[model samples]
Target: MLRSIKARKGWTARAPDEDFAGAAEEWNKWFDADPSARQGAKMPVRIAGMKVPIAMIAEA
Candidate 1:
């Protein structure tokens, strides 16, 4: 018999005023929407106009 492996959702750092759910949403919106900014650069959440800290492990 074999055991199936399930996907484990990771975490992120949220702003004091924001919760994890909201922060995750903002993170996804920023990164998912052709997230390229600053002439093809990978910058931080500041590009999204968000001060909330975040840590993401994407499939890319």
Candidate 2:
């Protein structure tokens, strides 16, 4: 996901004031727009301190 954001044509390092929720929404849009981006991707649930086999980040 970080790689994809960096790979975007005009993405610069996010501003200091930027919030994660806004960025996540934007990235989610990108992820959904391009079907290929989902191939073999396993997104981690970082909001949780401990790793879980299945963590929910967003509503499906």
| Number of the top-ranking candidate, with lDDT as the measure | 1
In model 1, the Cα lDDT at residue 22 comes to 64
User: Mind giving the per-residue lDDT tens digits that candidate 2 earns over 1-60?
Assistant: 433443323222333234345655665675555422221223333354543232122322
TM-scores, in order shown?
Answer: 0.28, 0.27
Q: Candidate 2: where are CA atoms >4 Å away?
A: 1-12, 33-60
Lowest lDDT block of 10, candidate 2: 35-44
| lDDT (tens digit, per residue) of candidate 1 on 1-60 | 101212123344543443645655654555563442211122334445665334333332
- The local distance difference test score of model 1 is 0.39
Tell me the whole-model lDDT of each prediction, alpha carbons only: 0.39, 0.37
Off by over 4 Å in 1: 1-18, 33-60
Q: What is the C-alpha RMSD of each candidate to the true structure, in Å?
A: 13.2, 12.4
Candidate 1 clash pair list:
none
